[model samples]
Each structure stands twice: as structure tokens, then as C-alpha cells.
Target: MKFSLFITGSPTSTKACHSALDFALALMRGGDHSLAGVFFYEDATYIANQFAMPPRDECHIGQEWADFATQYEIPLYVCIAAAIRRGIVNDSEAKRYELDTSNLAKPYQLEGLGTLISLSSESDRIVRFR
Candidate 1:
């Protein structure tokens, strides 16, 4: 089976991100399931913020997500509107907005809700974490 993940909780303020990661790991290890994609919406868009710096003793959830996506070749999509509203922008967006820097991390693409719909349509199920 193929599964898509929809996450909508703040990475720093909630366990949703970690829980999603755990679930994804399990799915991959199961050998019978695959991930179609991961959509970060609402507050979850913060997980793509490249400038985030958690304390040394804390887990860098953003980096963990990035690494997982890189290792598994899983598509990570962040809602463009939500990301921009939260001050998370890619290089092009930063240039378009005349911002000095871009803070969107790699492995996470800024996309619209249509991408999520597409992922959902292509997956057997959508597991939401919030």
C-alpha cells in the first residue's frame, strides 16, 4: 500500500512532526508500504524553515525531516501560501519579495493545495498528524 502524510502541527510546539516521522519510518520498514508524499500544512509549514535553531539538547525536527526525505526519496511539500504567511520562503520567492534571505530548507518544495490533492489521489490512504 501507498500512503501520504498530511501534517498540521507546529514542529516545536507539538509532537505531530515526530509522530509523523516515526510513522513514516515504520511504513518504510514494513516493506509492504510506501510513501507517496508528505504535505506540511498550516503550522506544520514551519518544519521547512531552514533558519530554525533548536537548543543543542533538543531534536532538530526540521533537519530530521529533511534527512528522511533525502534518504527515502520521499516528496515533501509545504503549502506555499501557508509557508509565505509564516515567513518561510525559497530563493525565488525571496527574490520576488525583495527579501535578503530564503529560509526554506531543502527536500521541501513550496506547493499549493492542489499538490496535496494530487498526492492524496495517488495514494491508498492519507494519514494526518495534528
Candidate 2:
């Protein structure tokens, strides 16, 4: 089976993001499932911000998600409008907006909601983490 995921919770604010990762990994380990994409929307866009700094004791969920995406060959898509509203930006966007910095992490691409729609169309299942 192939699946796409939609995440709407901040990693630090709730366990939903982590739980989704766990579930996706388990599916991969089963050898019969694959993740097509992970769409981060609303507050979940924080997970794609490279500039996020959690306490030393806490795990860096942004990096964790980036690594997972790389390891599993899953595309990580962050809603461009949502992310920009939350201060997440890539180099191009930063330049366009004349920002001093860009914080979008690798493996997390900035896209429109259309990407989510496309994922939903291509996937066998679409899971929401919220």
C-alpha cells in the first residue's frame, strides 16, 4: 500500500507528529507499504523550519523529520502560504521578500495546497496527524 500524510500539529505541542512518523516507519518495516509524501500545514509547518531551537533535552523534531524523509525516500511538502505566515522561508522566498534569513530545512519543500491535493489523488490512503 502507498500512503500520504497530512500533519497539522506542532511537534513540540503534541505527539501526533511523532506518532505519525512511528506509524509510517512501522508500515515500511512491514515491507508492503510506502509513504508517498508528508504535507505539513497550519502549525505543523514548524517542523520544517530549520531555525527552530528546542531545549537541549528535547529532540529536534525538524531534523528528525528531514532525516526520516531522506531515509525513506518520502517527499516532505510544507504549504508555502502556511509556512511563510509562520516565518518559514527558503532562499528564493527570502530573497524575494528581502528577508535576512531562510529557515526552511532540507527534505521539506515549500509547495501549494495543490501538492496535497495531488498527493491525495496519487495515494491509496491519506492519513491526518492532528
Candidate 3:
């Protein structure tokens, strides 16, 4: 089976986000199961913020998500509108907005709601973390 993912919770504030990551890892490890992509929406867009810096004692959840996506070669998509609202801009968006810097990093790309819909349509299952 193939699966698509949607996260609607803050990485640090909710255990559901971590559970989702663990579930994704398990699904990918299981035979013949593939992941289509992970879409971060609402407060979950913070998971794609490249500039986030957690204290040494705390888990850097954003980096953890990025690393997981990189290791698994999974596409990580952050809702563009939500990202902008949260100040998580990419290089192009920063240029477009004439901002001094951008906080979006690799493995997580800005995408519209259409991407989520497309992934959901293409996958056998849609897992949501909220």
C-alpha cells in the first residue's frame, strides 16, 4: 500500500506529530508499503522552518523531520499559505516579498493545497496527525 500524510499539530506542542513520524517510519519499513509524501499544514508548518533552533536539551523536531525525510527520500510539503502566515519563507518567496532572509530549507518545499489533494488521490491511504 502507498500512503500520504497530513500533519496539523505543532511538532513540539503535540505528541501526535511524533506519533505520525513513528507511524510513517513503521509503514516505510514494512514490506511493499510506500509513502507518497508528507504535507505539513496549519501549525505543523513549523516543522519545515529551517531557522528553528531548539535548546540543547530539547529535541530539534524540525531538524528531526528534515533528517527523516532526507533518509527516506520522502517529499515533505508545507502549505504555502500557512508557511507565509507563519513567516516560513523560501528563497523565492523572500525575494518576491523583498525580505532579508528565508527560513525554509530543503526536503520541505512550499506547495499549495492542490498538492495535498493530489497526494491523497494517488495514495491508497491518507494518514492525518492532528
Best by TM-score: 1
- Candidate 2 worst ten-residue window by lDDT: 58-67
lDDT, candidate 2, 5-112, per-residue tens: 999998888887898888878887899888889999999998887878888898887888888888888899999999999999999999999999898989899999
TM-score result, candidate 2 = 0.95
Instruction: Go through the candidates in order and give each one's C-alpha lDDT.
Output: 0.96, 0.90, 0.90
Off by over 4 Å in 1: none
lDDT tens per residue, model 3, 1-130: 8999999999878976788888988987886899999999999998888777889898877777788999989999999999999999999999999999998978799999999999999999998999
- Sorted by TM-score, highest first, which candidate order results? 1, 2, 3
The numbered model that scores best in lDDT is 1
Number of the candidate with higher TM-score, 2 or 3: 2
Q: Could you tell me the TM-score of candidate 1?
A: 0.98
Superposed by TM-score, candidate 1 places the C-alpha of residue 130 at a distance from the truth, in angstroms, of 0.6
Between candidates 1 and 3, the one scoring higher on TM-score is 1
Candidate 1 per-residue C-alpha lDDT over 35-129 given as tens digits, one digit per residue, 9 for 90 to 100: 99999999999999988999989899999999999999999999999999999999999999999999999989999999999998999999999
lDDT of 1 at 31: 96
